[model samples]
Target: MRIFAIGDIHGGLRALIQLLNKMEVKDEDTLIFMGDYVDGWSESAQVVQFLMELSQKINCIFIKGNHDVWCEEWLRTGEVNPTWYMHGGKETMESYEHFSNEDKKKHLEFFETMKLYYLDDENRLFLHAGFTSMHGVEKEVFSNTFYYDRTLWEMALSMDNGIKTDSVIYPNRLKHYNEIYIGHTPTINYKSYLPMNAVNVWNIDTGAAFFGKLSGMNIETKEVFQSDDLPSLYPNESGRNR
Candidate 1:
């Protein structure tokens, strides 16, 4: 069975549709979304609807990202951090015009049901962010470890400390998993894959939400597919809207 892993979508519905069309995925294949599915782009609702529909047609695994957690909170409490608006939450809210109360409820239910991490029998683990080494092996799935790990996000965003290098060392300590597929950290952080590690960790986030391309990787072959150009969202430096 072919397994295709995709990076942070951030509500770019067109890109998502185009990527899926390019893949021509079959029923036997498995599709894993690395997270950040909603927020940033113009079609957040459309992206969610498409993913909801796509779930029926293939083996789909959805891993929740930091943005997704914020979305869940906004849906539940009717309030979200103001800073999130600057980082694509505005687009997500704008895309909800067509959704009814019941539709939203169902969407929230679906979002809540998503797993924070996925581990397969082949010793491949998929996580939206890196795993917290403090959790040991089996306790990694608990909601606290999965949802509230601030250190994971801090390390992911830190550039000075060489957190990426630290992440490369982490999987060697795990006795079970042979490879970890992560997405929170964009791939631009590293020059190339480290050669010494037994654990093969592949990060597919190509910074589509920023000024980068959307990326996907075929799990079996490790062949990457990427969009040539970024979608128009933010304005250019000259103050002209894209």
Candidate 2:
């Protein structure tokens, strides 16, 4: 079976649907999501619902993103982080405003089940964002850096042709895995409108939550697929644009 890794959705349900359709996923295929499934757009609730349905049809792995953790905190404690709301949480809250109690519970349950990272038998690591070191996943679980760090990507990009200085020890933090896949940092940040690969790390968050397209990559083949620009899909609203 083929393995597909999807970047952050950030409430872009339409773009997510479009990308999934393009992938032509089969029941036997494995789907790994890097998270940030909500926030940014006006359909955060709908996006969660769609994923709930999709999971019933295929084997799905969901990684918890920073935004997703914020969502869960708000759901359980009725407290909101001002920063989160200012960024994209407002739209996410608006999306869930009219949901029934049962619907809210379902969404919370989905979020609770999301993993912080997944290590496959092939030695590939899938996570919402980069990790600090390769010591152990358990040691890094409580650190939000797994869902918010950019240093790993930056470190990879800083490498000259993926070669590091001799002073740096081998099997560095990132090299522990055969390949590392992440999505919290959008590729657009690097001025590339598509997925960016440096060394063995692949950043697939093509900025669909902003002014970019949703992207999905075939983990085994490294073939990438993208959706139409997201802003074009929701003309009436600005998606996550400050």
Candidate 3:
């Protein structure tokens, strides 16, 4: 069975569907979504609904993201966060206007049930953002760190090529897994619109919430599949670029 890790969807349902179609995934394949499934494009609720149905037919591991935390809280309390509203929550809120109370409950459950991080039998680690504990993710003190940390990717990016896993100077976090997959920080910020690799860490978030495409990568082969730029699909919408 093949294993694929998908980057943040950010409400880009069209892009998400396009990326999935490009992958030609089978039921036997395992798809690990790196999170931020809502907020950004015009279809935040639709994206979640699609994923809810999609999971029933295939192996899907959903990782909760920081944005998802904001959305989840809003769904549960009806209290909108100012920061979340500024960032893509406005779009996400609008997308749910047509959803019934029952639908909202189910989606809320979907968000609540998502994993903070996932570890496979092969020692591969997947999380929405990053973690801080040098001892490894299991030792992380803050659950929010799983979806909000950037230091993990930054540490990986600044890692020296010459430092071996056996070296005392090596980051302890890197030594815990065969490979680490993450989203949150967009690769576009670094000027690349593709999944990036630094040492053993892979940043799959290709900035689908901004101007870049939604991406999916075969973890075993490192084969990439991407959708058209989100703006291209939703021409009238600014898609968080605003």
What are the per-residue Cα lDDT tens digits for candidate 2 across 11-80?
A: 9999989988899989999999999999898999899999999999999999999999999888877799
> Global lDDT of each model?
0.69, 0.88, 0.95
User: How well does candidate 2 match the true structure, expressed as C-alpha RMSD?
Assistant: 1.7
User: Which of 1 and 2 is ahead in TM-score?
Assistant: 2
Best by lDDT: 3
Question: Per-residue CA lDDT of candidate 3, range 47-85, in tens?
Answer: 999999999999999999999999999999999999999
Model 2 misplacement above 4 A: 134-136, 162-171
lDDT of 1 by residue, 127-228 (tens): 876667654446665664553443444443333433344475543334356676777665544533211112355677777665566777888888777664
Number of colliding residue pairs in model 1: 0
TM-score of 3: 0.99
RMSD of every candidate to native, in Å, equals 5.4, 1.7, 0.7
Looking at candidate 1, what is the lDDT of residue 28? Answer: 95
- Which sequence of candidate numbers ranks them by TM-score, best first? 3, 2, 1
